[model samples]
Target: MPLFIRSVRLYPVNDNETFHRRFSVNVAVLGSLNLDVVFHCEALPIPGQTLLCDDFATGPGGKGLNQAVAARRAGAETSLLGAVGADASGDALLSFLKREDILTHGVVTLADAPTGVAHIVVDRDGENSIIVASGANRAVPADRLATAGLQALVWLAQLEMDIEVVGGFLREGRQAGARTILNAAPAIEAARSLFGDADLIIVNEHELAQFSGVPCPAGNDAAIEQAARKLMVRDDQILIVTLGAKGTQLVDSRSSFHVAAAPVVAVDTTGAGDCFCGVLAASLAQGASVPDAVRRANIAAGIAVGRTGAAPAMPLKDEIEAVSNG
Candidate 1:
C-alpha cells in the first residue's frame, strides 16, 4: 500500500511574538510531538487505586519536542518532523516551537485526529508515571519524512511514533551520510531490527535489561556494560546506557567508559534523559568528540533535573557551559 503524505505549515496563530535567528538547521528530529498534562501528587498510585492532586500544568512536550528544544538551546540549529491534530493543542505547540526558533516545516496536521497527549503524574520525588494517547502521532505518514530534508546531518529518532517510519528513517538517513541517533525510549519490539541503522543507541537501565533479557546491574559498571554490549551487533556501533544519578556508560567494540553525572540536587527529574540525548546530539553536530559531548550532555541533564517541567526546564548552551566550566 502506498502511503499518502499530507503536510501543512502551522503558523503561530495565538502567539504574536517572534525572534530572529542566525543559524541553519543542523539536527532534524523525526519522532512524536505531544502536549503534556501534568499533575503533581505525593506518590504514584498503583493499579486499581485512585489518587488526587492539587496542582496541574500543561505545556508542549513529547520526546521529539523536548529533544529538539534541548538541541536548539544547546546551540544547534534544529528542526522537528512529526504529526499533530488541527486543534488548539497542536496550534499552541507549533507556536511554542516557532518562538523557540525550531524549524517546524515537517509537522503535519491530521484533520481527523486530536493531537497526541501525555497524562503524567509526578510525585514529590520528581518521579513520574505517564500514559500517552498516541492520537495523531501514530498516524504520521512515512512519506512525510522525505520532505523534511533530513539528509546530511545528525538525525534524531525515538519510539513514540509509527515503528515502520522509525526504522525507515534511520535506514534512509544513514544511507544519506547522516549520523543517526536513536533514543530507544519506552523500549519496544520494533526497535530490535533498527539498531543496525543507528550510529548511537541511547537507552536507560531498564531498557537495557528489556532488550538483553538480563537484570540491570546494581551499581556495577562492568555488569551494565555487559548488558549493553549484548545489543551491539556491529563492532563500531555505540550503546549508551544512562544510569540515573550515577552517570552514563558508553559501550563500544574497542572499549567502554563511564561519564559521571554532575553533582546536583534534583527537583524534577522529568525529561532528564531527553535532555541528555538532545544535548549530546547538538554537541556532536557542533563537532565535539563523543566523550566531550557526553560530558556536556550529562551536565545539561543534571541542570535540567534541578528545574521543573520537560521542555521548559532545558538549559541554554551558556547555562550548560557555565556549569561545565564552574
Candidate 2:
C-alpha cells in the first residue's frame, strides 16, 4: 500500500496562525509524567565508585509529557493521559503542561503514590544515562481514555507505563477509528503484543533488535530492514527504526526507505526521540504522507538535540518549517 500526502488549505490569518492551522492535527498521548533531576558530569560513575557532577537541575519531564509538548508545539491539538502523584512536583508538572497548552483532563493525580522521577546524568558528548522510578506513572489505569473524552485522529503511547494500560489505549484508539502509534521505548518483552495493534511503531536500533530478535547494528541497513519487516502485522503497517545520527529507516510490507538526519551539533540528546515521535504523529494526523512526516520529524529532532532538556528542547512548528525550507 502506498502512502500519499493529503491536500492542505491555507486559512486567511496571521502568518503564524495560518501556518499552525495548516498543520492543525488532533493527537492524544497516553504515557508517563515525571520530574527530572539532572546531573551534568564529565563521565558516568561505575558501580561502587563515587562521581562528582559539574551542575544539577530539576524540571518537568516524562515520555508522555515530552511528547505532548512536542505535538502541541508542532501545531497539534494535543491531549495527555497519564498519572501523577498528589505532590508539589505533580502540581508543577501540571502547570507546565497547561502553559504549553496541552489538555490535561486525562492526567490523574493519585494520593497513594509519589510522582515519577528520572535521575539523568549527561556527559560532555551529550549522551545520557537515566534511571526512572515508576511511582505514580504505574498507577495509571487502562480505562483512562474512556473518561479522557479525547477525540483525536492520532493516538500515541510509550512504554513508560504499564504494558496492559498502553495496550488498552491502543486497542481503544483502533476501535475508535484513530490511527494508533506505539513508541516502544525501554523495550519490554510484553510490548510485543502491541505490534499488531499499532498502525505505526517507532523504535531505536536496540529496541528493534529486542522486538525482532535480530541484530540491528547502526550502519547495517539490510539488517535493519529485515528486522523492521518482521514487526509488520499488516500490509499497511509501518515500522520506523530511529538510527540516531545515521537518520531513520521506514519499512512496510510494500516498500522501505531511509531518511537522513539533519546535520547539527548536539548539546543534549535528551527527548530527541520523543520529539521525533510527537512531530511524526502530528504530521500524520494532519494528513501528511508517511515520508513527509518522517522528514519533518527528523528536522525537528535535529533542532531539539542542539538544545538541552526534554520537553523544553522541542522546536516550534515554524522553526521546523524554516529548517526544512532552508
Candidate 3:
C-alpha cells in the first residue's frame, strides 16, 4: 500500500520573496550539519605521499545543511531537523540556515558534542575526497521527530548521521503520510534495512553497486538499471541513480528512463549530488511528476558543479527556472 494519497498540484512562483507563503508544500530534512574545510589541490595525493598546492577555505556545510539550503533556494518551504553543538560553529550554521529562510526550530543544540566537521580536498577537475567527523551529528535523538511538529509533504534524509536514527526518522515520516526519500549516500550497509520505509531512494553509482551487490560500471546504463532494480522493495518504490556527468537514471516497477545532464564546465563537484537530491525533493513537494523533478534536479546539479562549495553552490529558484525553462 502506498503511504501517501494526497492530491498533487503544481504551484509556480514568480517572486522569490513570497515563494514560501505562496505555496503550501513543505519539505523536512533530517540529516547532518558540518563545518567544511576545503583544500584545493592540483591532484589528490597517494597513500604515504605528501603534497600540497593551491588554496584553502572554510564554510558552513554538511549533507543536511547543503540539502536544506538547496531546498530553500529551489523554492520549497524547508525545515531542517538535526543537531549541532552549542558552540560558535553551530551558531553560525544555524544562522546560515535562518538566512536562507529555512526553518531551524527543529534543529537542536547539544552541549556535549562539538559541531561536526568535514575535511575535503578538491582536485583541479572538481573531483573531491572527504573525511567526516560525526561530532554533534550523531547526537541527534531518534525521538526528535515525534515533537518536531513537521507538517511536511516530503521527508528527505542522508546517511551522514547514525543509520538507526535515519531509519527512525524515515519510519516516522512514513507513518505521518509524507513521502520519504532516502539518499543512501556515503553508502553504508546498515541503510539497506531502511529501504522498505523509503518511497524513493537516491544513490550514486558506487552506492547503487554497494547496496545491490552488483557491478555498476560508470556510464553503463544497462548495468546501472540492472543494479537499481535489485534494490526496489515495493511496486511503487522509485530509485534514482545519479551518474555524475553521465546524468541520472530512474528505475521503478512500471518503467525506467534516463534524464540527460545539463552541459557545463565542471569547477567543483563538492555539493552536486546534494544539490540534486534537495532540488528533487523540493520539486516533488511542489507536485512535479517524477520525470520532471528528475530533469530539474539534473539541471540544478549541473549548475552546482560549475561553482565551488556545497551549500553555496546550489542554484536558486529563479536560476533553476531560467535554465530549466531555457
Candidate 4:
C-alpha cells in the first residue's frame, strides 16, 4: 500500500490547539544558540579579491537555536536545552526565544564564555559560507544537561559540540523511550556514530557523500539513491537527502522516495535545511507519517529559502500550509 500523505494544511480548529498541545510530542533541542551577522554580496569574491557587498543582514542563527525555533513554529511543545554567554547577544536571543514560546528553562548562562557568533556571506545565488565560533555553546557539558524522559524527540546539531554528550542523551532518551533526531551539519569525524542512536537523520548532498563513503556525483534521483543506499538500510532507519533545488530524497530501511522541491525564487538559503528538520519533526509530532511529514517539510524549506535570515525567515505553520496546499 502507498504511504498516506497527510495534507500539510490538516491543522485542527482553534479549540483543537489544546489537544495538539496536550497530546503533542514534546521536542527538546540540545544544541547551540548564536548571533549571526550576514553579508549579502553580488557573487562570491575570489581569494585576494576585494569586492563591495550589496547588502548586510543579521539575525539569530545557530544550528541549535534555529532548529529549536523551527520545532516551536512547527507547533510542538518545544524546549531549548543549551548554554549561552551572559552577554548582550545572549540577552537578545533569550528575549526572541521567549516570544516564540520555546521553553528556555534549561538554557544555562556562562559568565566566562561569550555567546557563539557566526559571520555569514551570502552570494548572488543565495548560497552562503559561514564561519562559526562555538564560544559558550561549547561550554555545555554532559553533566550540565537536565535529564528528561518525557520528551518525544531530542535534537542536536554538530556545531563542533561534543558527540559523546549527544550520544549519552540518546542512550538516556531511549531509556525514557524518546525519539532521537540528529541533523549532522558541517560534517565531523565523530558524527559517524551519531546515526546509530537516531530515529531520523537529515542531510544535504555534500554531507551525504561524506557520511556514505561514496562519490555521490551531482545528479538527480540516481545520485541521491546511489548515496542513500549506502547510508541507510531498508527500515533500519530513515535518511533525508536534501537536493538544493531538485527537492529532497528520502530513504529508509523500506524504500526511498523523492519529494519534488516547491518552486520559489530563493533569496537566501541560510537556515533552510534547519527549517526543514524543524517542520518535519513538528509534523511527526502531529501524527504525520514519515513521507507526509517530509512533504510538509519540503514546502517549509522552500518557503524558508525565499526569505533571508534564519528566525525571521521561518514561516508560521499557516504559511507552510498555504505553500504546501498550493
lDDT of 3 by residue, 24-80 (tens): 337889889999999999898789977787678889899999998999899888878
What lDDT score goes with residue 64 in model 4? 77
Model 4, stretches more than 4 Å misplaced?
1-25, 153-160, 233-235
Q: List the candidates' TM-scores in order.
A: 0.91, 0.91, 0.91, 0.87
Query: Who wins the lDDT comparison?
Result: 2
| Candidate 3 runs further than 4 Å off | 1-25, 144-148
The candidate with the higher lDDT, 1 or 2, is: 2
Q: What is the lDDT of residue 246 in candidate 1?
A: 91
Q: Tell me the lDDT of model 4 at 306.
A: 90
Instruction: Give a tens-digit lDDT track for model 4, residues 1-326.
Output: 22322112232323423211222235777788889999989877778988787677767988878888887887777777778898999999999999998877667777899999998888889998888998988777776655443345444444356678777766676676666677777777577776777778788889988877876654566777777767653256788888877888887766777888878898999989888888887777677888998888889888899988987788788888887676
lDDT of 4: 0.76
lDDT of 2 by residue, 82-149 (tens): 99999999999999999999877678788899999999988888999899998999975665333233
State the lDDT at 271 in candidate 4: 89
User: By TM-score, how accurate is candidate 1?
Assistant: 0.91
**Each candidate's lDDT (Cα)?**
0.85, 0.87, 0.86, 0.76
